[model samples]
Target: METIFGLDLPTWWFLVVGGVFTGYAILDGFDLGAGALHLFFKKEESRRIALNAIGPVWDGNEVWLVIGGGALFAGFPVVYATVFSAFYELFMLFLVLLIFRAISIEFRSKEPMAWWRQLWDVSYSVSSIMLALSLGLVLGNIIQGLPIDDQFIYRGTVGDFFNPFSILMAITTLSLFMMHGAIYLVMKTENRLYAKLTVLVKNTTIFFVLMFALSTVYTLLYLPHMVERFKEVPMMFFFPVLTILAVANITRQITKRKYRFAFFSSAFVTAMLMALVAVGLFPNIVLSTIDPQFHIDIHNGSSTDKSLKIMLTFAVIGVPLVGLYTGFVFWTFRGKVKLDETSY
Candidate 1:
């Protein structure tokens, strides 16, 4: 009930939640995007080249996800429990896809057999699609609000979890990630692979643009409360506008085959869009449709000031180090990928 330093715990909860997801988008966005774009590489060597571009960083990129889960469990236990409980099936399915994709990324490259690699390629691409969709669905569910009972418990049925609004959100997320991956592939690969990616990104951009339009409609119609929240805040609206501009720029650049700039714009758009969502969900972490009293703010869901203080100290010390390590890895491996034709 008390404020921490200045702001309440709920505010900090939102900060951490938003920070983690935004960071993940910037880090894993390209990685997963590359996986989604993996289908564009028809030749085995081309595909392998794309994989190598991200091979060293993909696993580390996943650490943000772990950090997000850990933060939710420790800082916002209420939100974590309610969301997972209500979407048990979805979460389980998401886990399976994530694990399968990770494994396939490594194992697919180990074997030279055509069928073997094809199977893993399908697994990797499909898993990326599902992961992106599930992420969008989760965001939709949050924005649309959830069914909570008197005891502050979730009352969602299996079928209820996948409403039309959530499904549209899933499509939007998937399309955005696909575009993100396409741009990244174009940025990192060279030769025919890069040439092929320019065409792939052009095609993918159309789908993402369509999805963005549809998602706008869905948000306005189905999540009026969320729309209202954004409308009431003038500054907050800029992020989405900037995101749209960035997406448009990405498309324009990809048309001209400006690979690096398009990738940068795509990543920028993803980051900005995530920030917009986090801003939209501010003050209220979990909105209850049944009763306003059932709503959970960050403070109600967070640990004590002492725990936060300790972790904040550690986070301050460790975050920059993680950033440095990430930078070093990318810098060390910075260049176009070239796969061994003899190997898988």
Candidate 2:
């Protein structure tokens, strides 16, 4: 048990993996949110403006996902293998939808025909919605505990992943993303589109608040285990409290027409929510519903201490470089999106 700042190596790696995925969710979430709201912008110019709003950086945002996945595989191979195997079909579908979503962004403006653009618009919106929902479903199922046996093998069917709790989580994820995206769009547009998006931002905010409230009530009633950590360690309660404040500030900033602040608030809300998940599932990467003995935790699920030590060195150097690059890209593309002949 090599210690780093009072915590074990595996715990540090868990934090690393969680931080990377949280970055992915916050960065990529807005684009997916924008895509999910694509069809709502009916007019060609409005849709194109929306598409261009995310065009310069959507692909770059996915780099965090790749990093997160790699970190997961490196740090927690057992949890990776078990979860991926358990949700093989769902992951495959998620992959296909990801491909379609990427292609829709690239190919939507290739032709002048209404039918062609309309086809890709539907594909884009549907793929974005499903992608967000699928992520939520996976998170919900993971938090709720999986049916894993003693060997760390999942024994549940694919159908088991579609339970009511998971569905509620999926909807909540979608709504949150939608609200996040609308805020980003509002920040990146002006005039009529900006005004329209302000209205949308409010609506999406309401939608997310409703879904979040329902999810909160459902979890408190049915998944009481989630709150046990906060109860045991009262300090951990700050994350949820900060999350509520961030959610509240989203509306406050939006109402004040400070969309940049609103967008940052949304991103903070995203980070805090993920932090809540990490806090709730600390130590245990995957919980087994069948038996506590089957639970895969940081210690059992992680690689050798030496491996983590070596990879941690690389991560220290590499992750900051990725962050710098991401920051540079966003800085370069700062301000309103203007449609041009070369725009997508």
The candidate scoring highest on lDDT is 2
lDDT of each: 0.79, 0.94
Candidate 1 backbone collisions, by pair: 10-298, 10-299, 33-181
1-344, model 2: which lDDT tens digit per residue?
A: 78988988899999999999999999999989999999999899999999999999999999999999999999999989999999999999999999999999999999999999999999999999999999999999999999999999989998999999999999999999999999999988989988899899999999999999999999899988889899999999999999999999998998899989999999999999999888888878899999988999999999999999999998999999999999999999999989999998
> For candidate 2, what's the RMSD?
0.7
Per-residue error at 328 for model 1, in Å?
1.7
For model 1, how many clashes?
3
Candidate 1 structure quality by residue, lDDT tens digits, 85-143 = 88889899989998999899879967768999999999998898888888888888888
Model 2 residue runs over 4 Å out of place are: none
Superposed model 1: Cα runs more than 4 Å off:
1-6, 340-344
Give the top-scoring candidate (TM-score). Answer: 2
What TM-score does candidate 2 reach?
A: 0.99
